[model samples]
Target: MFLRTVTTAATLLAMGVTASLAQDPIEERQQIMKDNGQAMRVLVPMARGQADYDAEAALAAFVSIRDDAARFGELFPEGTETGGDTRAKPEIWTDREGFDAAVAAFVEDAEAAVAAAPADLDAFRPVFGAMAENCGDCHEVYQVPEN
Candidate 1:
């Protein structure tokens, strides 16, 4: 009897730890977006000629954004719309296909930017612009405007 009781308690404890390990989706998604934004800040100045372009830094930035974009759709799971101070729109759940397509496009653009490997500001401009546009397009329809 004592062994059975101890086993059940251990099982319950393990479940509690597992549940706590899962982040709230809204916070998780926001952190991912913030990380992507930080990566952009590293590349945008170089692309705009405001800072000297470093190929390695640019590649790293693209990789960061692409990695984050790859997981974008998975982060918007249902029931995550209103809580944890989310800026995600309800339309994300209703128009899931559109939301998903946008994420795919963002990922594609990031990959293209990485493959292009622009060595200078001029070469990087168009690729950077396209990626920025993808971000704006997704934000326009899926995210709530910040006050």
Candidate 2:
């Protein structure tokens, strides 16, 4: 009986740990965006001529954004629109087709940037600008203002 009780306790503990690790969609997407923001930090200074452009670093940043964009859409599941301090606007669900298109554009632009593999600041600007525009467009329509 003691052995069986210990086994049950261990199983319950394991389940609790699993539940905690499984972040809600809002938290997951926020983390992904935070990661993308970090990647942008790596690229922005180089684009601005404040930091030396490194092909490897630029490629890695582009790849990160591409990867995030690929998975970002799944985080907006039906019930997640209004929780966990989400900045997502209702348009994200109401205008689902448009939202999906924006995500696709971001992914496409990031993939193109990665494929281009910009070797210098001159080469990096256009690709980065295009990807940045996609971000701006989506945020303008789909995100709530901080103020």
TM-score of each: 0.81, 0.83
Deviation of model 2 at 136, angstroms: 1.1
| Alpha carbon deviation, residue 45, candidate 2 (Å) | 1.2
The digit string of per-residue lDDT tens for model 1 on 71-99 reads: 77898887787888889999999999899
Q: Which candidate tops TM-score?
A: 2
How many residue pairs clash in model 2? 0
Task: Spell out the clash pairs found in candidate 2.
Answer: none
Q: List the residue pairs that clash in candidate 1.
A: none
Q: How high is the lDDT of residue 25 in model 2?
A: 78
User: What is the model-wide C-alpha lDDT for candidate 1?
Assistant: 0.79
